[model samples]
Target: MGSAAPAFYGRRVPLFFNPLEAAAHRLSIAPPMFDYFNTLGLHALVAAARLRVFDALRERPSTADGLATTLTIDPRTAEVLLRVLAGLGYLRVKGGRYRLTRTSRTWFTTDSPTSLVAGLEFWERTACVIWPRLAEAVRDGSPVTPFYELLESDAALSRSFQAWTAALARRQAPATARIIPVPRDGGHVLDVGGSHGLFSVELLHRHPGLRATVLDLPQALEAAADHPRLTLRAGSFLDDDLGEGYDVALLFNIVHGLDDQEVAKLFARVAAALNPGGAIVIGDQFRDSLMPGRASRTLLDLLDLNYRVATGGRVRDFREVARMLRAAGFDRPRHRRPLRSVVTELAVAVVKSPSRP
Candidate 1:
């Protein structure tokens, strides 16, 4: 009787053959669902960060109830989130307690020098909202919400954006300083669109004789660190008059946000700002230069899409940049020696003569 056949809609079916169970088995054996549900993971991570769950774990390993009491969340929900994070490798469970993993301890903790909390906050606040409009941007041939316009409208978001970029810049500046040469005779260095001024600061440290001026929007300068050798000028690099007689100039991570004409104009401006034989370094992710099947290439490709949706910017290859530099009256552009930590390639050009206005 236990192995008897069952009737399903007037048809005899084997008792062991359950349609729902078979369907579930098929779905489980299909390709992993993680890829399809990646957004869920990202949102969970963002929520955990915002709730300071990692910070709580940093103090001591705790069970879900302990976390709930500490963070003022429901125990069941806390348990679910902790379990998800543990699966994501940011946390681990041992002895009935959830603890931050090494990766989370270093990056999620507020006190850590390399902490990414600010960056994550900015992403959660701004980028997450903007990314959903990528399709609209593609359809309209421009960003639905312009990056600068978004920053200008929201003061709090603007500050977070600055801090977020500054954190990344601080990490990259040391490697950037190593690749680019600074003038030995205490020449002026102009940093165009230098939001946080960390790159200028790093260069100043490497070349003690160098004095640098950072030119960017006033709001962007709010988070920049002050140094005796560094002067912060608050204005748009495109609209503002860049003071002349600079020996070296940097345009790090900026060109992708401009059109071809704008890049040429920017190069012309840099050329004019430089003294004869002064060097101009353009640092950006050149799509053509990236190797195939590499993680950096994929990262840059996504970043290129981001710029397209956010700023009407298109990431160009090194050849395209070189063409623009030449049109602006600079000498042939050459790739600077690669730095380990700097994924963006550096292209250098020199002013032999003043660029025609």
Candidate 2:
């Protein structure tokens, strides 16, 4: 018999095996690389831009020394920052002079409509700090809670939290508009933890028959009084009693930021508020076996970790959520894929029989 090669080194015979399977296995197990590279470049860009490096460059393409003179920075430090930007494909260097690359021209211009500078500034000031506590959060349970604890004395931090929450709602409003379902008739829709009523506004716009009630912190509500079509209520889910007789209740990106007990209480509350045959729609990231391309639970797991540390909450699996729904009086839960990123799962549960209630 011929000598056998080690398993680590594929033999000539093994070469005939399927390459696709091998590639798939490798990809499945490999860690995400260059993860910090983009963030590093962003930080550098923000720092350099704040120092007026981009403004100086726009004025004229000059050597590092001349650029430093204009910006009032050390020539070596300016050159280093310029090189970083070049490596990130934002700038180009030739013969010791620099100019904005084509990629930067469109975005870096002062009056460009697509400027992401403000968003970048927001991330640098807030998100960056919160991300580091993700591990600690995962072990504890709430991403923002722990962060708030750390910055409890800082009033600005508290304001930033609310601001970012609204900003995030606005950013995803378009995407959420596409996925969320609107009732055929003027059915009542309850928005749990929805900020600024953006999703409600979209729901109303998309489905003329749909009326919505947005439940959020008192300060988060944009409108006063529950209108004939649209209503905004101010109260915490834990303390306030949920109004009854909702045809559809929406929990968007809310449950994941809560622990099991809190989630149980929320589902129970939602069940109590739901009318007969009414459905509860949950929108969030979940671990799904069927939806491969649509799932990003792993990337979101980091966010889960942050939530854990910050709020004492966690993202639950589909089965876990289903069980919670069932315990809260839901019948068989149904899943839907109306959009990407936001998984829409519905559970129709009985609150109480007419004989009992």
**TM-score of each candidate?**
0.86, 0.64
1-357: candidate 1 lDDT, tens digit per residue = 111221111221111335664455455643334333455767788788889999999998999999999999989988999888887678888988998888788777777766777777567754569888878988888876668767877778888778777766766788878877677778999999898898899899888889999998877888888999999999887777887999999998899988777787888988998998898988887877785644456567778888888877888988888888888878968976466655667999888797646
Model 2 alpha-carbon drift over 4 Å, by segment: 1-39, 45-155, 158-175, 222-229, 289-298, 340-357
RMSD of 1: 9.7
Which digits, one per residue and each the tens of the lDDT, describe model 2 over residues 125-189? 55577666656655644354444344335545444455555444555556666755455777888
How high is the CA lDDT of each candidate model? 0.79, 0.63
**Which candidate number maximizes TM-score?**
1
Model 2: lDDT to the true structure: 0.63
Deviation from native of the Cα of residue 313 in model 2, angstroms: 1.1
Candidate 1: which stretches are off by over 4 Å? 1-36, 126-128, 291-295
